[model samples]
Target: MQNEKRDQLVVSKKTYKKSNELINAMGKGTALSQKLFAIGMQNIKVDETNNVVATIYGTELRKMFKSSSGSLYEHIEALCDRQIKGATIFDWNLLMKDKENGKIEAHQVVTDASFKNGTLTLRYNNSLTDKIVNLQKDYTVLSLADTLSLKSVYSLRLYEMLKSAYDYQRAVTKMQGEMVFEYKLTELKLELGIINSGGSKEIKTELEKEFPDYDRIDELAEKTGQTKYKEYKIFNRNVLSKAKEELNKKTSLQVDYEPIKNGRKTEGIRFFVTKKDAEAVEKTAEVAVNKDEILDDLIDLMHDDFKLREIRELAELAEYDYDKIKKSYDYMNSYSSPVDVPIAFMKDCIKNEYYNNKTTKFRPKSSNSFNNFEQRNDYDFEELEKKLLDN
Candidate 1:
């Protein structure tokens, strides 16, 4: 029983169309129809006596219904029976059942009725209030295409289709090429032609027969075409040839591959030298080191922590003048403590030693008489001798 009532309330497309037709027909100004429609629009309220009343300004009501004779109730009854035409009123009920223990816990009725003072009213018992309130908010007036002129409806639909076709053509052009989009251009042309030539049913039928595969071609072309119809074939062929050339060039490139082995293997000769050979090489290198080379190496070794001492020792061993040694030491001290002796200094020392060894007449300046040495040297004799002999 409940299911039947529910089904009746569920309006179908056909019923919705009928309702819209009624609204449009009433809009054309049928007297009774207009009055019934106006009543439906009015706000209905329940008074203290539980009687529903439809309230509006007296002048407004008269203006809408075009009547001032008889009571408002009489006017409403006449309007409902005549103006409403083939409309029917139904009484709906809400029944609640508890499945947990299987019980008919609540039952209530909701009825659609007309009030005495012309208010269209629906009443639901307290138990069914929630359901009734939910329905009221969700209710909507139905709309139908036929309610509008045929030309207006067709124009709207055709506009949408044309828009869709234009978008499809644009997308296809971006992806593939103009040739791929030829079908879309064809479809758009046909649609535009139809629209321009007056969208007559006879013309449409003739065009459909002439372009039997219109829909299929339009859909496929939308998927395949690049941008525009004129360039579709040309663009596709060019892109294909370019791609093939690129693939061929890539495949033709030469590449050398090296094989991988599980473990490392030596394919070339490996030689080993004995400790005796290494010792011999070291002794020969030591013999190659002359006195000047040994002095330079010792100077380098001590230069970092004792620059002044190393320079004094180097000067004494090389038999350089005190002034010259002092100047060289000062110049070397101007650099950072960890000094690298210039290769020029090493070469000069080597040359000086070679010349000294070759020239046996070379004499130490300090070896002259104390008075003569004193006249030439600024430092005291004892101090000069100590520095020279200490190293």
Candidate 2:
């Protein structure tokens, strides 16, 4: 029986679906650990014994993060120690079947984790198999690339929450309206692990006692503080703002929030989430380009610099007529002068049928010319005419 269970796809941009409950899992880990958890989900499959497991390799980790040889092993060791120490909490308050009650279940996600030969093998808890594996509906599909690109654990958690909420509204609700989510301030803080709201009063009391200065965000406490994000302003500045910035800069989602207030006190947060087209995540996850293919090849061969995302948007503009897109791309590339912004110029060329203007060669007077062009003294008219006639 084959024991290995990992994805065959070389690129991590592949998508994975998780139940909404699981997506909102309040378990916290380091940014890399959270990323590893996402990768585990992406590579999830049944092992020889029919148990769900994910196998990750050190070499793969190095490649994914582009880490050096010496530090990579140390990082892997640190990750293994964290998982073994139960630092990556999978504990979640899963909803009961009655739908009126919630149960605080503390379960180790990696029930059994072993590191051998620079590979880590993890066996998931039996109780979570249903939530993580057997999903029928109310699931959120996420890109592994997008999740991995997030640097902060808060950003990752918020991204998952917003993505899940947006997907559910669009697909399940089907209301054909704007997607918005409102969360109580305390609830949001709890979810982001900013504050501890444990199941037992004893645990909560213990946290409060240990971090007695948790809520002190005064000018003095701001300089030297034990706990974090006790005040709404501090929380907004530290967690919410950073998460929003990272999400907008790195992921496909655009998110903004307004504080729900009552009597000058913050009550809750209302979030507005929207998805971008064609350009989902960063190009950090570079899929090996196939030279024979037009979209991938163009992405690979283009002399102009573009984010993997911008290139994808350009391909989407092609509308399956890659030949025309290629012509525009060639026109942009063959121009004697340098283009200030190649993508914008190529987009205009594709949009306005500039690629097909065979009679006259268009040369721009300035670097930012998109609508108009002026002839240059060093214009290679002979070569341009030759190329046009050949076409």
Candidate 3:
């Protein structure tokens, strides 16, 4: 019974999508609060009319947070006080669409919360939901398993930041190049919630507007007692290094970074990220461990665009029929040219048995070649808007 119940709460295979804006939101919360918030976001369900709400049972919460001390209800109550701190301005102009640019912000994500009979109920702000729901573009997929597996708030946030940036590099920008992330040192610190409420006079003034009572840095620290990594060396060692090590070792991404210098001072960071191959996938999670050897073999044969989770599911569906699956994979890859979305095409080929007795070259209705693409050449509008709108 214990094993069965534990199985019911396993979230390692679940995934959620969030807009790039939400992924980069300057949100601050405790590690547990962030995990809870992520789980809440994952479970949010929208009806035909677009109404949505999330309910988290105390049983699952206790299971996930068994390591925490004190009452679980207390944590739920404290969740209401957490704030998301800044508005996000999405520049639709970059897409070259005719639509106007839009702005969305929410002071608090968990607008209301209540616990009764060992279950916690949460109502999210509409502004927060609007960005996530029905997102047509500029979004990133968040693995609930990956988020829950991470222990530190910094690691979780860094993972999301890098993941979103990597997605943008791949999808929207159509770069089709190696994953690279460069951020100003001050901006990086703020994104990770490390040096909150600091920087130039303009930045400080804007942050002050969010909390009128704490107008000055010292006053804010005195009242709320800020925990900040002010020293660059310490922040690099404790936050960035630790998160990088954890993300590389445990998650689907392998990351490495170095600080950029200006004369004598470190001014920015440049990160290199890549997707792990089959061998690395085999080493990380227990689910991969328990799968048959055929799954790893299939993963080795597949492309990078297909996620590890999706490949795992596909492997199970194929029922270890290596020959049949391999035929489908070969059919897709050996087509006249690459499919616009190879994964979707491969799924159909396998499900519909299109590989059976196939001899002719398969041609997609249309194909978008990702080869020889250049890096993003424009950052003017986005940088300006972020500087003006972000806290």
Each model's TM-score, in the order given? 0.17, 0.59, 0.56
Candidate 2 C-alpha lDDT tens digits along 122-230: 7776766777786888788887767766667799889888988887778767764357899877657656755443344443343334232323312222343314776
**Global local distance difference test of model 2:** 0.60
Better of 2 and 3 by TM-score: 2
Collision pairs in model 2: none
Off by over 4 Å in 1: 1-61, 66-75, 78-391
Give candidate 2's TM-score.
0.59
The model with the greatest lDDT is: 2
lDDT of 3 at 266: 80
Candidate ranking under lDDT, highest first, comes to 2, 3, 1
Give model 3's clash tally.
0
- Model 3: what TM-score? 0.56
- lDDT tens digits by residue: candidate 3, 40-78: 775677644444567788767755543222334544543
User: Per-residue error at 350 for model 2, in Å?
Assistant: 39
lDDT of 1 by residue, 77-160 (tens): 433342443322221221233335433232323233454543444443444333322233322232111111011212222222
Off by over 4 Å in 2: 1-12, 47-51, 82-101, 175-178, 202-227, 279-391
The model with the greatest TM-score is 2
- Candidate 1 local Cα displacement, residue 107, angstroms: 14
